[model samples]
Target: GAGVSQSPSNKVTEKGKDVELRCDPISGHTALYWYRQSLGQGLEFLIYFQGNSAPDKSGLPSDRFSAERTGGSVSTLTIQRTQQEDSAVYLCASSLASSGAQHFGDGTRLSIL
Candidate 1:
């Protein structure tokens, strides 16, 4: 796919384990976003990167969860000491700008035991 790509479509890990999810955005897209979709929470924004700078980091749910974008192309989300409540579909999207239409990937379904 030439668009947003997320790896390892599904994952299962025990509580207290750590997990890392990857997202590769479309070429030349300067803005990338991460979101979480859960049965109870619909879509919750996690984080995003614009160019090589991050203007916002408020959407992250906790200190245990963090993300970084390197070379302004690939992004990785890391969750430490995972809990059952952390289970959800992690979605990745990219656009030309913050307000532009976003292109999304199939998402990574994470399950915590």
Candidate 2:
């Protein structure tokens, strides 16, 4: 895809379940970021992955949230022991550099029952 691409656009699961969300950044992009947006709220930075540097997982709310970028391309976000609070739209974005504008995906709407 020419832009950021996310899959499993919608997901439903139980509170104790675990899920994985995937993202494919545009080719040649070096910076990738993950964000979460709850209904009625704006996006919150979850994590960031930049070429070769250690992933910035500081924005993650807890240990259950994690992400990784492989070869500076595809990335995945994992949520363990999903809770109702975890329900939100997971957005992925990519840019040529950290300071440039980003291109975002449609997002994955996750629902925890």
Candidate 3:
């Protein structure tokens, strides 16, 4: 893809159900990030993987949320035991390196029923 790509533009699930969001960044990008945007709220950092270094998971809200970037390209975000509060647009971004400007995907909108 020419730009960042995300799977399942929209997802609706009952509370307690788990969901996984996928992100495919621009080829050759070495930095990948995940963020969440809630209604009327600004983007909140979730996690990021930079090269082969250990991923930074400090931004994750809880143990239920986890993300991983494989081979420095595709990334996945998993939410366990979903709750209504977890509803949000999950955005993914990538940069050439840790300090480079990021390119973002359209995002995956998750709804909890």
Q: Could you give candidate 2's per-residue lDDT for residues 1-113 as a string of tens digits?
A: 67889998999999999999999998988999999998776789999888999988889999998888887789999999999999999999999884688999999999999
In TM-score terms, candidate 1 sits at: 0.95
**Can you tell me which runs of candidate 3 are displaced by over 4 Å?**
none
The sequence of per-residue lDDT tens digits that candidate 1 reaches over residues 72-106 is 88999999999999999999999997467999999
Any residue pairs clashing in model 2, and if so which? none
Better model by lDDT: candidate 2 vs candidate 3: 3
| TM values, all candidates | 0.95, 0.95, 0.96
The CA lDDT at 24 in model 2 is 94
**Runs in model 1 with CA error above 4 Å?**
none
Output the worst ten-in-a-row residue range by lDDT, candidate 1: 48-57
Task: Please give the CA lDDT of all the candidate structures.
Answer: 0.92, 0.92, 0.93
Clashes of 2: 0
